[model samples]
Target: MNSCKVIDEVVNKGLCIGCGLCVSACGNNNLKMALNEHGFLEPQQVSGHCEGCKGACLSVCPFNSKPNNDISTETKLANIFINESKNHNTSIGKYINTYAGFSNEHRVNSSSGGIATYTLIELLARKEIEYVISVKETITTDSHYAYSISSTRDELLAGAKTRYYPVTLAGVFEKIKELDGKFGIVGVPCFIKSVRLAQKADPILETKIRFLVGIICGGVKSTFFTEYLASKAGVDVAEYRKPEFRLKDETSTASDYSFGCLDKDNNQKTIKMRMVGDMWGTGLFKSNACDFCDDVTVELADISLGDAWIEPYRSEGLGTNVIITRSILADDIIKKGIENNALTIDNLPISSLIESQRGGFNHRHNGLGFRIKKRRSEGLAVPPKRFEKDELSFLLKLIHLMRMKVRKKSLEIWKKTKSAEQFDKRMKPYLFLLSTLTKINHYYKWYSEPGAIKASLIRKKSKIFK
Candidate 1:
């Protein structure tokens, strides 16, 4: 096992899990991951110390990173579709819930509604999976890395939310060979795409990974942002250990106080901040990888879930999912669950869901591929779809900027909320962009203008990325 190979796998595959175990294990400076290409977070070499230890990295690797199988069949997707939807927005087959939700551990602790955690839990509870090869922060450090934690229902309850610091994909890479039962994975769009790429490179993953749960994301940042929030809170910084971002006790309003964290001795450290409604890429502390991301939502995942952040459907202090089950199995499970009253939902159209997700905006990355294709089809090395302030592109950049700015405020709000419902009133306005524009409407959140212009010119030189 070459260190370069391992590092490349970790970087490109990006299951890093953010454990920092490899950093400790690497006797040589040969290994490190410091803001690489696309920059959602990847591992790199400080020099080449990790260059020689193939097996060593594996020894310390957490997630059993093995490629499973290709479920890219219409039959599978169709089956899930048929099974989960109960005529309206859910699958009807053997479901126990209308939609999958677990206000359990991961949700209350998560950035969005904690749906990803619940999805994994549902899989485990149903015996559809053996262990989960997802990323988690180890007890020892704030850094995250992948770990193939076995689920007994109990373990699933333990990790149901989001970890902002680091997520290690390498751990999964190390332990994959030992597992036998089907597994599941949850990640932001880029990570899901990377996992898809990994499946292409190594087929074993497709066989084992029964579910690829995707979360719509803006991007991820370093632990620095959490630190930033904590610093503003007037807490004793030196005593910090592990920090949980949100804490709630079922109250509503400013005095209710939604977010908090924990330190080394399990002391609940509560801090407060301002609020906003958006989740994912607001770009304040997000990695550069987000800018170049081609997928706003990983279309390939078995199931894609995200906050329904648009209009009439949004509950101020709580969370609702704009769920799209890629296949029928997922659909069926959800459908049955709802009919059985194990789940509850508000029927939503795909358009409503998309609006909630703030779709329609284009960016350099969005136009990039089409730019390349347009160039290729037109007989050019690179297309010349340079950014323009014309109606379309101008609006695209505007929306992107607004999304970022709102999310920056949102991180502050999230740190203070715990209501499964009752979000700030300003957060639930539909048609945020259109509402600001001459009156359009959205599913949730207030809309204004796509006002910022940091790299407004980048849209101009997109073809010259090389």
Candidate 2:
């Protein structure tokens, strides 16, 4: 690894695909991708995770757009689909024939499925909700965060794609007064809690809200990852203008990506950045904030969406989704839409979802694995005495580390192939060195601070006391 590698700027308001290449790269046990509030897996920083490695993680990030302050969003299309689905379609308001890429695409490009996003878009089109209460990208001096708030279709679509940043409903609650009227939302479990709190705080919202959609995220990132990326892309952090993650794509996979921005010269620059097996789970492309998160399934929301990590669909390009309807009203809308030929429907299970999607908190967060390790350390768990003859642990650790490095290196090579070959070649080594010293909170670093830590222990303690 180069010692003088360049580090990217902090990313505040976007998603991380959670691929885990960085974890593979680090010979030292400093980096890991863990679950966040929403359930999706993300990069985390263990105290000693980074062995002064830089290029491995930073080079692999696909979302880091040029940071800009002049960013903005507004509403787009708003047309109703009366009855435009098929026999397989289940609900009128639940699916959209108007949109080419909707209707149970859950078998295709999504996490759990395509239903939740479709649901949100349908409500917006029907004008049932004036704005989708969601997280829009935010720019802070240090980095950008996907601050929670209300969003129009244009805004939501613009903000689409995974943003590995921490999102909270508290911010969205503050923005709700301006939206005022029937509204929908897309968020994680914690965000749903915040929304419930907001509704409790205001009686009108209880009436005004028409729908709620939650994403099954593993964790969120800090703004530091964003800034670090921008800096590496030859974009100046001080003169940064705006940042956009997952700049729209017909292809849902992370591999087919294009970056866009107006450079310091006010000239627009777009870059095609794509690779194989690109998903948010890559540890190389995540935020440190993820490790602290505890929720993954989005229990508080009426509906939740994610990718269906199943075989046939997972093989079909990367831009698909999965959806789960938990609320009666949500189920009604989807069901009605399907019956009216406005959408399609399907019955599914939680396990099927976990296996198909990337890292969510349910089975993906390493919760089970962590428990196993903890038990093993405590002597509550043990290897077979016959197997104890060999220290398989060291071999397993070595394999994991080496694999991560190979993946990280492969990604770096892929990126340079698209950019200036010579320039990127020279820069990669330097950037590798820089990425070592350069640490970010969201995409690459994992945190252990007690301030934002989530705990089941607290709940258990309260129950025990009771």
Candidate 3:
């Protein structure tokens, strides 16, 4: 089918990730990406006339068809330049090496270890790539962030931290088509996958996009997330100007979120993240498409980077990255950076790297089948997934259902919330539902299984007594 079919099935079905590949692939400026009432970035047809052109847009869309192919299929299809796999994990696909590291200069100010920023800068410095595309704060709006092209180290640094908001490649793809040069792009798994699909359809993209740097994603938040935070922080959503998430706090254990806007007196007002309520865990503003995805490590990327959420690294206030390199070029760059003292790195077991994002993996992979089944039971359409259907334990099924319930109710409650206190009051029951599931999962894991407590103690003692 054509772009129209794609809109009817994926976009209308709420399965669109808003990557904007379809808009670019349409090739006639027939489609444009814009924010919907739900604050999701979606495509709308600008021209009603059908050019009767061949539909390349449908083939390039990642969500157009069921992604039922195995991990090996993705690796084999995407990793055309790499042959051998050095390490493998069920959740984190083929990798040449895994490491924990940080950029000496950027660690403190970055959201994580700053490896992603450093790697992009290194590529630019060596002239390996002429330009890099990433996300940076929007100068004109109080909206969170937007896609930008960075040719200099300072420009790259400006986009360094994790944005945690929805960004699209419609503009970036237009620029790539116009400009002629080697390029590197940083994005989440689905975005990278869409780029690969576009590259297969267009030869110029295949040649110009020399590198793909993926960021491990839990999911992306919508503009509603920012608005919700603004409201909680006492800033009027209508008056809110600009917002930043994961603001660096050298003294605090976790990063804070903040926003700036002019008050009635025309004085600039700023609000910190704490007042906005718990953005994480609640999963209130997460895109629906994210729930259907299973690629937590961005397996299709040349190199994937994320926070080292496991012990030792997690305790360090400066932050650290769990890096998985799939391309020889990425491995070499990281190796050289370590050699020159630009980065501090150490080889870590693939297991440790997987452990760093255990929660994300469990939810995205293991819990996905149940979610799919739930949708199907309701006669709802679902995008195809690689995960196989398996019977979940009763408690696990209940937990999954509870999470969905909480997610749905939280969105409704957010719109009606008049004050932070009311927001918290209404959200308490839903949050309690999540907390109860967490406790049940923990208790079931340790108490229900024979010797589970003993095994846990041994693991803890081994770490401490070592």
Candidate 4:
């Protein structure tokens, strides 16, 4: 079978994130994004269409690792915002200012303070963009949500809340070609980066896309993630409809939210995410591409939004958003919102914004380094990352390895057994080992601290006995 470079380099290596930029970038229409056996979207090559191809798909692929063909996210941001942005950092990238707050109007229905939704709406209201391209629920049963074009306030509002399930941009890119107006897109870091990469390779996209709004993401889950959750919640997967990944309870804190889904009969079932247990941190069902990604703040985006997963905001049931504004226009819209009382926000120190996503940074930064090193040691190809491979402690290495195993095997085990119990049983040994190592590393660091008085006391007592 003939294949595109993307298939041989990314998809075959398990690094495809299903962003679908490859499908949209294929000038010959040689590729189509389809759901694979693992329930993640990937580009499938059409026979005979790749003849004399110029490799546009590989050029735009986020996971593409072709030597000297790679365009780093940092370079992309500098090319666009070097003079516009006031600050830059390795972790958060370029930014004019960082803020922590939420839209007064959008917080109720939003997953996290509605900052992203509010920003997209304001950009439309201000006539900055002709349309907003974002993920929204579809009427069809084949997929719950897909990327859509929305120009109206109600349309944008209907697309609110977090969607953990996988989605691709193949459809929206096609729509962008048919539509004749400027557009703004909302996406996660990897998706936003892919769009930027596409724009560089395709002049048409560069002219049409006006703004990029980014979501601070840990990783995306496969469709099986939803099925597993629904199955555990006693909702019939066959009838699962209108699944809402984040449903807030006024009595509880922002992070303490529930997952809600509707049955065929329209009955809604709700379950707290905590009840689902440690799926996010444990990397269950996460795309392997996520393990290779290092961009946490969507550095290429004009502005980025994330759940303020810290402090008083965490305790606030209404939800809060941590934002990083990298473009002047994005900053202006936010400042105008503050002036009009449309938003209630505070200027956040960059440190505070970074702290809000400390776990994400640890994984993308430290954990990523370990994974790259391990892959290279095995003589396997790995995607190019911003940070170099790190020499990690043995325990840290074990923790990272266990995470990689969980992400890879979750889908495999689910595909075979389709039973959450079996999945959990198979995962127990990995989880148990990980948990033990984590505790040991934690205490070891604590006792190794310079002022660990308990350590000092123990040493003194032992010396006296000797």
Runs in model 1 lying further than 4 Å from the true structure:
1-41, 46-114, 142-148, 236-238, 248-259, 263-267, 273-282, 359-466
For 1-466, candidate 1 gives per-residue lDDT tens digits of 3445445544344334343345434545456545432223455666533444544443343222332223232223234322443333221111112232433345445555566666677788788887776655566543433344656766665665555655655545435546668778777754565555454444576577677777666456655456544444434444555566545433442122344555556676565443432233334445433443444544556677766655533433445566666567666656665666545556665545545645413443343443344334655332122232234344444555454455444444434442213223433442255235322212111233242432432442342221
Best by TM-score: 4
Q: Which candidate order results from sorting by TM-score in descending order? A: 4, 3, 1, 2
lDDT tens readout by residue for model 3, 66-175: 43343224554455533455666667887889999899988877888889988888888888898998988876553457888988998888888787677889877778
Against the unseen true structure, what C-alpha lDDT does each candidate score? 0.48, 0.43, 0.76, 0.83
Question: Model 4, which residues run further than 4 Å from truth?
Answer: 67-70, 81-83, 450-466
Q: Give RMSD to native, each candidate.
A: 11.5, 18.2, 3.8, 4.6
Clashes of each: 100, 117, 3, 0
Model 4, span 123-178: residue lDDT tens: 88888888998899999768999998899999998888789988899867878878
Q: Which of candidates 1 and 3 reaches a greater lDDT? A: 3
Using lDDT, give the best candidate's number: 4
* Model 4 clashing residue pairs (backbone): none
Q: lDDT for model 2, please.
A: 0.43
- List TM-score per model, in order: 0.61, 0.49, 0.89, 0.94
